[model samples]
Structures are given as structure tokens and as C-alpha cells.
Target: MKEIYLVGGAVRDKLLGYPYSEKDWVVVGATPEEMESEGYRPVGKDFPVFLHPETGEEYALARTERKTAPGYSGFVFHTSPDITLKEDLLRRDLTINAIAEDCQGNIFDPYGGRQDLQSRILRHVSDAFSEDPVRVLRVARFAARYHHLGFTLAEETRQLMSSMVQEGEVSHLVPERVWKETERALREPSPHIFVEVLRQCGALAVIMPELDNLFGVPQPKQHHPEVDCGLHCLMALEQARQLSEDSEVLFAALVHDLGKAETPTEELPRHIGHESRSLPLIETLCDRLGVPKKHRELALSVARDHTNCHRAMELRPTTLMQLMQRLDGFRRPQHLEQFLLACEADAKGRTGLEQHPYPQREYVLQALVACNRIQARDVMEEGITGKAIGEALTRKRVSALKQFKQQFTTQDKTQ
Candidate 1:
């Protein structure tokens, strides 16, 4: 008899009426030869996985796992005709992900996954959940993704995660795995929750000590009513979520303020020149995690120039042009826009200013438009050569920027 069950996120998402990206199935009591004979392409190496001929969905034989050593790679898996779906589900990380649905649409949840899902709780499937340190990150990611749905980690699951951290399991996590989880977390609706959950479970210290160190650092109460650097980071991430869906903006918002953590204790609530201080920190983090170039570049720009972006209206035309050049605004306007969004998140992340308008963004953007209006070809057409042309181009752009600033002031006065 052939027995196949829709499993993992497919079942959980269908039950919750959410759209899932892919479907995974567990085949019980099905031999490899029989699966291949039915036109299922063999794809598994460590276990029996095949692709359906028509749907291209993954179907893996029911398997059970045991901890042979440390880390996620140390697991010893057993797959045979005797392995039950219950046994396979027991090896899963979260209860909500362990539920299975049959072809006849019957639900098979022996571990109370349905109850946990209905309760909107993220509960561990078993003690073995702690065996895989990656599961800690997965739980936090789930909290971030489902935060809008009122889903939270179960106390037992949190305790297990904390234990895993204490046992040094998180220290063995590879950089690529950490980055993969973090990148996904940054795209979640409530990315800040991902950081908070990891910090709560002690995984942040192991995976990202620099980020963890920001927790107790002080900030000026007048400018940042949140008062703590870590909370400010969370607020900024939330603001970024509201401003843009671009993960580059989100990543920049999260790490742009990290330099405040390195501020001297004698400085107290004042963080002068923290922008420059953030540059090395950002580089080290990106290097450590192998962060993508786009995210790394935007984060560096936000860290180095966010202060200038916030003071857009007050800057001189020359200063504005220099700022634009620093961000390579002429070549990559999209990155500049992302930089502005990150800066806006920083300005509005304060306790009472979340909904405040950030017109500085438009102010700087207008300056860019003014500069672009003085095209190099137009400057070249003016009969100059060598270094003279460069100087002339700069002069023309500066004059345009000044006029643009005056026009902005005039419009503001009339409005």
C-alpha cells in the first residue's frame, strides 16, 4: 500500500489559509525503486527524496534522526519502511510545522500541532529541537513573520533555545547559515522581533555580539526618547518597515546606529561623531557574515552620512553636492533613495516621533535633481577644455543647487 502525506509548511499554511510557496510530502512505506518506477526523479543523497513527474513537488521518505554529535550537521538519520510519519514528525523543529495532511484531506497531528497553531504559539516538537542550533534562528524568524498574527514563542520553546545558547550550540552555527536566517528575518513584517527573540534566548551574544552590546548603551533623551540604543534600533527597523520593503533599507536601519555602543562611558547620553565610528563596525560585520554587496554598501552609506541627510535643509549647496558625491548619487540614485529612507527611519525612530514627517528626504532629493540639471555635456558645450571644464561644471552645478535651495525656501514660505 502507498501512503503519502502533505507535510511541513504546506499543511500548516493550508490550515491557516495562508499561501505557501511550495509543497513537501512524506512518503511512508514506499521503496526507492517503486518511486522511480512511478516517474519520481531521484534527488536525495542523505535520504530518499524524489520529484513528482507532473507537479515537481518534493517527496521524501519518512525519516527519523538522532544526535550523533554537535551542530546541525551531526544528525544521524534513519529511513526505512518501518519509520512512521509520527517518528518523522517528532524530528521536526516546531509543532506547527510537524502536522501532516493526507490525500483524502484528513489531518494527522499526533503531537498537538493543531492545538499549538490555533493558540498561535510556536512550540518545540521535542527535546531534539535543541539539537539543531539553526532551529533557534528558525523559531525567531517565525516570530518575526507571524508577529502580526499574534504568534509568539512558547515558554518551553524559549527555555530550550536559551539552554541551547548556554550549551554553546549556537557558537557552532556557520556564518552562511546565520546570514541566511538573518537576511530572511530582515524581510519579515516585524524584523525587530527577530532580533528581540534572539537576544531574549541569548543567541544574539553568540551569533552577533556586536549587536548584543548595543542593548544598554545610552542615548540623548531629547533626540531619542527611547533612551536605549538597542530599543532605538528596533524602533528604526519598525520605521523602515513602514517606509520601504527593500531589505537593504531594513538592514541599514538595523545596523546604522551600532556605533553608539562604542561611545565612551564618560560621554553618556551624547553620541557625537558616532557616524564615523559606525564605518569600521559595519565593515567588520559584513566581512564576518559575508553580507551581500548591496546591503553592505547601503549600510555603510547610512552609517557614514545619515547625519548629513537629516540636516538636508540647513546644508550649503556645496556641502549638499559633496554629500551626493559621497553616496555616488549620480551613478546610483536608487541607493541614494534607500539611504534617505534609512535616514528617515533613524530620525523618526524616537519614542514620540514615529509618525513624524521627514521632509529632509525630499529636500536632498531636490538638490540631486538640481545637480543633475547641470549636465556635463551641457557644461562641455560651453567651450572649455582640460581641468577648466571640470571646474566650470562644478561651478554651474553649485549655482543650480543654490537656486534650487532658494526656490525650496520660497515654496515653504508660501505654503
Candidate 2:
């Protein structure tokens, strides 16, 4: 009584008309010995999983899991020839992921997954969803991926997530699992929804308290019409998505204003020294989550120098050269572009300002181009040598920036 069926994301995406790359299969009434005898390769470390001989796609045997301890790794899986597809699907995290399709184009959804999908809802399969803390992050990621399709979390599911948080289930998630889900969510079309959904479910407080702390904090209304620091951060993340598809840039934008959360009560809405305060928070968060070095570097740059980027038109030539040096922009020009895009997102993410002009981005780019035109080789060709050579190169770069600024000013006056 062996049966093979398509399962998980491939089946869900196919039904939704969304393009998906990989397909997962489920095998019912099949044991590992039978699978190997049939030429499938054994691969699952925790349960019964195999690889198709020709296609190399994953095929996991129908299994059920039982909670033995805390955290996502505390589960004991039971797979046998008697295990049914419905039992396997019941252990899934969400309803939309529990539906399965046979090779004959027959779908078996014992869990109302099709109804939930059609209704644009992300609902947990059962109360057993609370057994694994990673489901919180997965639900948040799904919300982010399908946000553009008008999907929303079912209220009951949100309540369950909230209960999980209250019962301390979310606290058991490891940093790697949290970051893995977050990185995937960052690549989604509506990444802000990931954070928003987590916040709504109270998981943000447990997983990313630095971000959660921003919600009630207020900012100057005139400058940030969104007013709430967290809302502004989410808006900035959305804006970054519109500007560039780079996840690092989007991450920087999402966290550019994190320092505002630490602003002293006396400062109220001004957040005068929040930029410097943001650096340590960013470093701490990055270290805790094992974020990639590239992401941490860009986030640090945006946190420290984004204000300078916003005021690019007014910064002196020497200051501009120093800014470029700090960003290592002279050697890594693409890094400069990422920094500027994140800054631009921050400037435009405010309420009623989504379409506002950000001339600073182009101005900074032109300044970089101007500085780049004065090559070190050309400077060395001027008979300059020794330690003074670096100094002399800096002077030339500053002069070139000065000229670029003057030309920009002249062009501005003409218009």
C-alpha cells in the first residue's frame, strides 16, 4: 500500500499560481529498507527521508512527531509503514503547508488547508503547533512571503502564538533558527510584514527585543509623521525593498533608527545622540544572531553615517572625503551604493513623504565619481613618495570633491 504524493511548499505554491523551484514528496506505508531496495537514497538524519534516484528531490516518509522536551530540537519522530498521510500532515506548522497532491493530480487536504489558502489565511494546523518554537518564525516568514497576495494570520493562530510566548515556548528558539527564518523573510517582497506579524504575536519581544522596544517610542512628528519609531522602521524597510533587492541594504534600513529606542526621556522626541547609541545595539544584535559580516558592516555604516548621507549637500569636501574613507568607499564603491540606498530609504519612509525627492543619493554618487577620477597612480606619478604620498592623495581627492561641489552648486543656482 505504498503511495507517493507531492507535499509542502511546491504543492501550496502550485495551487496559488506562485512560481516555486523545488518539490518535496511524502511516502506513505514505506520503510527505509523498502526505499533503499527501490533505489532511493537514505538522507534523513532524524527521521525516514530519501532522495529520488533520478531527480534528486527529497522524499520523506509519512511520520508523526512527539514533544519530548523544550525547543525545536526536542521532538522525537515516529515513522512506520502504518503511519498515515493525515497523521503526517497534522504535525505540520501551518494549514496551507499540510495539503498534499498525488501523481494523479488528486489533492488530499484533511486539514482544511485548501479552504484556508483560498480565504487568504495563515492558520496553524493544530494546537500541537505550539510544541516547536520555530513555527513562530515560520508563520512570520509565510506572512511576509504572501503579504502581497492579501494573506493574513488567522486571529486564532495569533492568539495561540501569543499563548506560546506567554508560556515561554518562544524563548526556546536558538539564535540560528531565528536568523535563518529572518534572513529568508528579509528576501520576501514585504519583509516588514514578517516583523509586524512577529510583533503582533508577541514573538518579537522574545526574539528581537531591541526591535520590539521601538514600538511605543515616539519621534518628532514634523520630521517623522509616522511618529512611532517602530512604524517608521517598518516603513523604511518597505522603502528599501522599493529601492534595491539587496537584503543587506534592507536590513540596514530596518535598523537605522534603532538607537532612538534608547533616547533618554529628557530628550523626548529629538533623539539627538541616538546615532552613536545605535552602533552598540547593532553590534550586540549582530553578534547574538550570527549575522553575516557583510550585513553587519553595512548596518554599522548606515547606523553611523546615514545622517551625514542625508546632509550630503552641506558637508564640506574634507568631511566628505573622510566619510568615503570610513565607508571604505574608495576601494569598495558598491558598498557606498548600499549605504546610500539605505539612507535614502530612511529619509523617505516617513508618512506623507514616500515620493519626496532625495537628491542627496545622486549627489553622493557624483562626489564618489569625482574622487575616483583622481587615481592614486596619477598622484604617485606627480613625483610624490613615502608617507606623504597618502597625505598628498587625500588632498587631491578633497580638491576634486571641492570642485564637484562647486559645479553642483552652480547647476543648482541655474535652476
Candidate 3:
């Protein structure tokens, strides 16, 4: 009873050969009061949990409890000196996470977790899995992480998730928590699993009702052999997931064309101005998910300017300079790379766009490079405000800047 054990993700990740640094300890013979006696501080506001003062590690006292509510919000926790470590393992989300390891590296697998791990299946520890709708998101995330590893959802768990969605357990989840899980899943090696799970469980409609409208909306046959707006969106989201796990970029990509579902037409299959229309919705979603203000603004900018990549090619030098100024001297190579990647992913995800080479993209990228090399900030430091610079150039100067460098135009090149 004196022995404590490491359990859950630490053990599961260890077996999978993933770096398992964060450790969760379950004390077998300790109560919260006993842990307090050992100088551990109780910290779990939502549940009974504590932290070790020296290591700052979390320690949840072992307990055996029963449900008082019908769902996850209904739990009644009971901790005791008599409860064993096995009791705590049984109450976890999945069999893979239910396994425990002691300090000496001895593993305890009372629920055939090792076998399920070997088989690459995520099975719930008990019927209690149905009680927590959040498990649905976790399962989806696990599917994304373990898909290449050959993991599949267990039948009972899948059925339970479907049932939970049908029962509207999704509303029990807070927006921030759900967004955190969804964003994490999107950042995975493949987030298609997350989408598929959301589609199957009916949870996607709960959070993103706008997407549900795209289900059967067909696209123009000439461009999209994929058939519908939803399918195209799914493909785009998959591309986004593969491109980067940057939460803001990924979220923006996923909903960048959301307005298309409402604005689809026979002539231009994807609704024009959909990017602009989606900004407010994305902002609301970002707020609901508790994303930072800076990230929200960046994502909104990506969505708003997604269509502007083409327009950038036609910009006169003054206009180009204005655009660069608007970007506030974003001179870093990685900044340009991230913007181009986001633009390219958006472009590649669409169909029937003019095949004209993205000259503006190339031009802007080169301009960004030049801006860095010449230290555009130094130009600004030389008493050149963006408005001041814009006023300095004449119509002729603007035209010349847009065109090839003629020596006659070189006169205006100086600030």
C-alpha cells in the first residue's frame, strides 16, 4: 500500500516508444489528507488532485468511486486508505491508458491493456467511457496519432461515442476544452481521423453548424470531380493538417471557405467573397475556443488575404510597398515561408482557379526578401512613414515601380 505508480499516458506512451516525460502518479495508500501530510498541495479545483512541492509533479490519490450523475459531469469521487492502484486504473478512459508502471519499471495490466496496445486498438476500460463525451475527442486524437501505428477504435467504444452524441452529451463540454482537444487533433500527423470521428459521432454539427450545410452541396463537375463542397473542404483541411500543426493556421484553413456552403452557385461553384464572409465566424469560433487575440488576428488575416495573393501580382510598386508596410515589416524568412505555405495550401486545395502562374506570390516573396536585405526598417527610421512614402511617389513613379526598372524611374527609388 506504500507503493505509488505511474499510470495513463506516461505508461502508454512509454510502450509506444514516444517520449514520456510528464508523469502522473497515483498513490495507492494515500488520501488527500495523507498527501497533505507529506507536504503535497491540493490543486485540483475541478477534481480531487494534488501536486508535490519539490518536483511539481501531480499526484492523484487512489480512489474507488461510483457515478451520481448519468454522464461525466455526474461523478461522485471517494478516496480511501484501503483502495488499491488497480481500482484507479479501472476508472480511466481507455485500456491503453489504464495500464500502470511502478518506480522499478514493473507494469500492471489488469484489463488486457498490453494486448490491446499490441493489437493497436483503443478500447474503453469500462462502460464509464460513455459517461464522458470528451472521450470521443480523445479517441479521435488517439486515432490520428496511432493511425500509422495501425490503431483502430474498438467496436464498443465507437458505439458508445455515437450514443453519447445522439444523447447530446456534447453540450456538456465547454467551448475552450473542446477547442483545445480539436486543435490538438488538428496538429497531429493526420487530422482526417478527427474529422471522420466528428462526422460519425455528430459532434461536428454541434460546434460547427455551418459545416453541416455543406454535406450534399455539389460542386461544378468540370473542376471538382470530388463532387461536393464538404468533400473539397475535407481535402483542404487534410492538406492543412499535413502542412502544419500551427493551431491558428490550421483552424483558419479548416473554416476559410465556410461561406461557400451558403454562397455556392452554378457559374462560380465556390462562392466568391467567401473568405471575407468567413472572418467573423472564424473570429467567433476562435474566441469560443479561447485562442489568443494575436493568433485570432493572424488567422483572420490569412483568411481575408487568401484571395489577395493573385491581386498582389498586379500591384504597382507604391501599392506593393503599401502592402509590405501593412504587414509591419514582417521581414523574417520564416514569416514569408509561413504565409506562402498557407497561400499555397489554400490555392492547391481549390479547383478551376486560373492556371496563371502565381507571379504575385513570387514577387511579394522576392520583395519581402529585398525588404529584409535593405533593412526596410532603416528606411522607416529615415523619417519615412508609410503615408509619407506613399505621398512621395508620383503616378509615374508608381507605374515605373510596377514595371521593370528603367533608369528614368530610378529617381523615385530613393526615400
Using lDDT, give the best candidate's number. 2
Candidate 3's TM-score: 0.83
Minimum summed lDDT over a 10-residue window in model 2 is located at 371-380
Q: How many residue pairs clash in each candidate?
A: 0, 0, 0
Alpha-carbon lDDT, every model: 0.91, 0.93, 0.71
lDDT of 3 by residue, 64-97 (tens): 6676765446777787778888888888899999
Candidate 2 residues 151-197, lDDT tens each?
Answer: 99999999999999999999988998899899889889999999999
Strongest candidate by TM-score: 2
RMSD of 2: 0.9
Q: Give per-model TM-scores.
A: 0.98, 0.98, 0.83
Better structure of 2 and 3 per TM-score: 2
lDDT per residue as tens, model 1, 1-415 = 6799999998998888877899999999888899999999999887789999999999999998878888868877788888888998999999999999999999999999999889999999889898999999999999999999999999999999999999999988988899999999988889999999999999998887778889999888888888999999999999999898898999999999878889999998899989888889899898988999999999999999999898889999999988998899988999899999999999998899988999999888878888888877887788888788878888888899999999999999999
Give the candidate order by descending lDDT. Answer: 2, 1, 3
Global Cα RMSD, each model: 1.2, 0.9, 5.1
